[model samples]
Target: MAGAAATGGSARSDTYASARNWLLLPSWAVLCIFVLAPVAMMLVYSFLTKEFRGGVIWEFTLAAYDQFFFDRGLFGDEPARIDWTYILIFWRSIWQAGLATFLALLIGFPTAYFIATRPAQTRTVWVFLITIPYWVNLLIRTVSMKFLLRDQGPLNDFLLATGLIDDPVRIINTNAAVQIGLFYSYLPFMVLPIYASVERYNFALSEAAADLYASKWTTLRRIVIPSVRPGIIAGCILVFVPSLGAFLAPDLLGGAKNFMIGSLIEEQFKGNAGNWPFGAAASMILLTLVLVILMFLARQQARADREATS
Candidate 1:
């Protein structure tokens, strides 16, 4: 009787395990098919050669990556010279993204603090207002900004009419316009995370600090900032990553004059420069970079967690 009971229990456990595996099969299938398959294809393509006219040649070669790192002189026969154009673009993208992240933090922290400090009922209202911009399509918002910033647009006209300047200022199709577009588009991303952190914060600690004769600035720097560091890190990552690969803002606001990595990738795929393999190489490089950053952040967070527990 004891042996029979154990056998029955083991059979039931096996059945349950099988059922769970079956339930999870579809999600695993979708991930493999949709996500892993494309990435695998891109990785394969990155090693191949680019065709003269378009697309890729299946012959595996590192020429695509070589092109990025080395210039084969003017005639493609001399010793390879280092190409700095793509490197410059990469650095510029990093700089612009970093600047945008910093600006977003500067603006988002105060906005989030204000919302978090509001009465409970009104806090929801403020958060809703912050999210309202997302209801509109991003492309539409960026295009609208272009209309407003154009030399003869309402903004310039208003300024000119008010004698702010002698003539219409060139706001559109400039780096400043691109930065403005990026800031406007990603500000909510920055604010929402910080708001989530601030909302959960202990106001009593701040009060206690004040009671202990801590100045507002001292309290903010020593207490509030440290408490919300996670949210700040999250917001910075969210803003910087997307801004690094931003396409529409640079294309529409900055134009051809201010080409970025996103634009370069687009050009490889769709524009006159149809070198799919090269594009894939660039994409893989970007993906690797992002993955490295995420891993570093994950390690740091894990260390922080261990330290806190200890």
Candidate 2:
């Protein structure tokens, strides 16, 4: 009788496991269709020769990467020199994205703390209010920002009336504007992750730190930060990666003059430049750069985990 009961239980377990495996089919389908398929397309496109105008030829060549690394001059005949143009654009994108991440972290950490420290019932309302403005489309939000920061717009106009400066700040088509847009666009990504971390944090540990005579700053640096480091890292990654490829913010705010990697790639496919191979190459390069950074971070995290465990 006991053997019979065990056999029935094992059969039920196997049936449940089979059903669970079947349920994963849709998820795997979506991943292949949306993520893996597009990445594979980009990789293949990068090697193919660019057609006369916009498309790719079956012929494979390294000319796209060569163009990126070595400048063949305007007519494509001169001796190769290091192309600073694209290098500078890549550097600019990295710097701006890093700054945007920093700005989000700077503001996000405090905002998250404020919300997280609130009573459980009150926290929901705070989160809701914060997200209310973002309910509108991103395009509308960006355009609204442009209107507010334009030379004759409310921000500058208010400054002028109050005698804040001699001239309206040249912010409309500047890096500063790009930073602002990036921050506003992804602040919630930064905030929510940190809030999730902070919300789950053990406040008793904080109180214990206080009783042990640790200063607030010391407690934050030693206790709070280490505990929430994962969330902070997650938030920074979320903000930085998207800002790196942000076209709308740079295009609209920087007036297409301050070209980030995204704009540079966009121009190849959509703008006057019809070099599809070069665009694909640039994208693959960007993708590679992101992967390298993520790997480095993962290594660092692994090292930290080992140290903590040791």
Candidate 3:
């Protein structure tokens, strides 16, 4: 009788396993079809050659990547020289994204902390106000920035009327404008994650630090920051990754002068320059960068979890 019961239990377990696998099959199919398939196609396109006309050549070549790193001179006869233009644009994207992330963190942490410390009933109000800008489309928000920053726009007109400056400052089509736009656009992303972290934090630890005669800065640096490090990392990643591929703000605010990786890719895909293979290559590189960053963050989080448990 015991052997018969054990056999029945094993059969039931197998049935459950089969059911679970069947339930998961649809999701797996969607991922393979929608996500993996496109990525695989892009990877294949990146290795191919760009035709003189639109579309890619079937022949596989590394010319797309080669074009990114080297220029064979104007006539294609001289020795290969390193192209600093692409390198400069690449670094510009990195530093600008980093700067925007830093600025967002600077503002987001304080805002999130304030909201987190507020009465639970009123906390929702604060969050609602923070998210009001997101109600509008991103493209509209970016375009609205142009209207505000234009030479004859309200900002310049108000400054002129108030005697702040005799002349309208060149705010549009400049690096400063692009940075400001990026900070404004991605601030909410930073705030929301940090708020999530801060909301769950134990204020008792902060009070304990105060009782121990710790300075405010010391308490924040050592106690609050350590507790919310995951949120800060998440916010930074959320802001930085998107900022790297930002096209609208740079194009609308910075114009031709502030062409970024996103703009470069867009140009290759649809603009006057139609080099799809090179665009695919650039996209692959960006994907690799994002994946590496995510991997590093995952490792750090795992290590922190282990330490905390220990």
Candidate 4:
């Protein structure tokens, strides 16, 4: 009887496992179809030779990647030399993204803290107000921003009328303008994450620190920040990653004077350049870079989880 019962239990377990696998099939299929397939297609295309205008040829070569690293001058027969041009573009993107992330953190932390500290009933209103500006389409908002920041726009005109400056500040077509756009665009990303962390924070701990004679700054630095660090890191990652690939803000605000990585890839495909494989290669490189950042974040998260449980 015991043996028969054990066999029945094992059979039931097998049936359950089979049913679970069948249920998961659709999700896995969608993931492969939507995400993995495109990546695989890009990887394959990055190796193929580019056709004259827009398509790829079946011939396999490392020319796409080689072009990225080595400068082959106008006719493609120049001696291989380290290409600083693309490298500079990448560096500029990184710098702009980093600056944007820093600005977001500086502003977002204070804004999130203020909202988190508000009466619970009113906190929702504050959040709603913050989100109102973002609900508009990004393109429209960016265009509006461009108009507002233009030399003769309301901002400079108001300043000039107030006798703050002799001339209009040239903001509309500068790197500073791009930085401002990135910061404004992604500020909500930074704020939301930090607000979540701050909302769940223990007020009693802060009160206790104060009772122990800790100054506000000291308490914040030692206790509050350490507690909410995960949120800060998450916010930075959210802002920085998107900023790295942002084309619209750079194109509109920076006047397309400089090419961010996104713009460069875009030009390759849509502009007269029309180098499909090179565009695919650039995309793959960007994907690899983002994956590296995600992997590092995952590792740090795992380590933190282990520490918390331990």
Top TM-score model: 4
State how far residue 183 of model 3 sits from its true place (Å): 0.9
Off by over 4 Å in 4: 305-310
The CA-based lDDT of model 4 is what? 0.90
Better of 2 and 4 by TM-score: 4
Every candidate's lDDT: 0.89, 0.90, 0.91, 0.90
- The local lDDT score (0 to 100) that residue 293 gets in candidate 2 is 83
lDDT over C-alpha atoms for residue 270 of model 2:
88
TM-score per prediction, in order, is 0.92, 0.91, 0.94, 0.95
Candidate 2 residue lDDT tens string, 1-310: 9999999999999999999989999999999999999999999999999987799999989999998889988899999999988889999999999999999999999999899999999999989987887889988999999998899999998898899887997788998999999999999999998899899889898999999999999999998988777778888888999999988899889886789998999888985567999999999999999999888777766664565346
Report the lDDT tens digits of candidate 3 across residue range 1-310. 9999999999999999999999999999999999999999989999998976668989999988888889998787889999888878888998889899999999999999999999999999999999999999999999999999999999999999999999998999999899989999999999998898899999899999999999999999999988887888889889999999999899999989898888888888895469989999988988897798889987887775575446
Displacement of the residue 243 alpha carbon in candidate 3, Å: 0.5
Could you tell me which residue pairs clash in candidate 1?
Answer: none
TM-score of 1: 0.92
Evaluated at residue 183, the lDDT of candidate 4 is 93
Worst 10 residues of 3 by lDDT: 301-310
Query: Per-residue CA lDDT of candidate 4, range 54-89, in tens?
Result: 898999999999998888788989888999888788
- The number of clashing residue pairs in model 1 is 0
